[model samples]
Target: MKLIKTEDAVGHVLCHDMTQIIKGVTKDAIFRKGHVVTEADIPVLLSIGKDHLYVWEKEEGMIHENDGAEILCSICKGDHIERGNVKEGKIDLFAECDGLFKVNIELLNKINYLGEMMIATRNGNFPVKRGDKLAGTRIIPLIIEEEKMENAKAIVGDEKILEVKPFIHKKVGIVTTGNEVFYGRIEDQFTPVILNKLKEYSTELVEHVILNDDHEKITEAIVNLINKGADFVICTGGMSVDPDDKTPLAIKNTGAEIITYGAPVLPGAMFLLSYFNGDIPVVGLPGCVMYSKRTIFDLMLPRLMAGERITYEEISKLGHGGLCLSCDICTFPNCGFGKGM
Candidate 1:
């Protein structure tokens, strides 16, 4: 691009977006990049204090900001993702469907390390609704070396830098364990909480079983739910170390591989995650989930619904940013709870 006086740029192409700010009203692009500067736009440019402007200049071995941003988009774009038209050298990405959003942090950092280029994304491994902004790609300069953009693509290779794993329909089963609830001595509150949570997903209440702290009976109930086409099973209560607490043992008896018997998160330290027959999830929930506004269950539920396997290493990392502030007005998922390092 070439820098020239705004008055003489009438026929030239704008190399970048011109931002027009209105105090407390609006601030947005008035003239987008690639716009052909006409006679009528000179006064508007001058009003914004633009005495000089950069005009597009075709050159070999160099790419404009919009083109560079497009390459960055190619590097990061993945399944179920959408990209907005480039503006001011930036391209914004969004989710095309409600699903699990993931970011390859390593790849993102590597690309950003390349000077004059950037990719900013929302923290990943969280559920996002359709049309949620996923990420943005931009170039710092009006133009960049073609070699630099090529290097960025090479870093990503074939793998996407961001992905939206679509959520699938699930048949959820609930097993409420505790002698008080099983014997009807106390109201069964856990099932109501579970049902409310399931309302956010495409799930059906396939089964609901109440059982005493007897590990054998709990195990039978869980296996029976899965055998009857339940893709996900959750056992509430009996997760702590009191001898009578037997939900963990019951989950073990079901032959599901336990991901973690305890997590580093608050309001859910005694959480248990497991998978039966290599794919079906069988979770053991602590009592906190029945009342807490947000817990580890909230963090892991979307991933499980998207069919992503949980690992012990991943659960251990929850120690960072795992404590919930428990505000009077809870804005979960949007808050820092369970957003680990």
Candidate 2:
């Protein structure tokens, strides 16, 4: 690219988009790239404080910013992700379905460290809706070294840096274990809370059983649901250390592989996660989830619905940002809780 005085150039092509920023009014590209500058366009260019403008010029080892942006987009695009038109040397990626968003952090970091290129994305392992912006990629300069973009692609290799795994329709079952609610002595609020959360993923609640804090009964209920083709089982209450809390023991007695008995996250430290016969996951939710709008359950549910087999190590990483601020108006997923886990 070559730079020429705006007033002296009337027939040259613009190499980059010229943005116009007005306080509280507008910030957008007024003159797009490759627009042939006319005599009357000089005054408008000067108004935007453009003393000199960049014009397209072929340079053998360098790439135009527009092409560089496309290369960056290609590296990040994966299943259920859509790309937007390039603007100002940037491309935005959107989700094509409501599902879990994932980022290959290692490759993302390597690509950013290579310099002059960047891919900014939303936090991974969270739910996103169709048409939501998942990520954006851009080249720093109007023109960049082709070798730099090549290095970025090499860092990503065959793996996509960004992906949106569509959530699968799972048949869920709930077993609320509390003597007060089982006998109808008190209203059962846990079932409604669990149902509402499942509704967000389009999951169907296949069966629900209310039983007292009896390990044998809980175990039997879980087995019955699984045998009936329930995708997974959820046992609420009785997950704590109290004598009456036997949900954890019930899940253990069912011979499910316990991935974790407790999490580092607040509002869900007593949570239990296990796999039944190495397939169906059985979750034991604490009482906090019934009251708190967001918890460890919200963080891990998307991953589970996306068919991910989470490991204990991954759950252990939740300690870093597991404490919720409990803002007056809870805006979960957008909050800092359970980030980078």
The residue-by-residue lDDT of candidate 2 on 268-313, one tens digit each, is 9999999998979899999999999888899888898998899999
- lDDT at 329 for candidate 1? 95
lDDT to native, each model:
0.91, 0.89
Q: After superposition, how far is residue 44 of candidate 2 from its true place, in Å?
A: 11
Candidate 1 ranges with C-alpha deviation above 4 Å: 1-58
lDDT of 2: 0.89
Residue-level error in angstroms, candidate 2, position 284:
0.4
Worst 10 residues of 1 by lDDT: 332-341
Each candidate: RMSD to true structure?
A: 3.9, 4.2
lDDT for residue 322 in candidate 1, whole number 0-100? 93
Backbone clashes in model 2, listed as residue pairs: none
Best by lDDT: 1
Off by over 4 Å in 2: 1-54
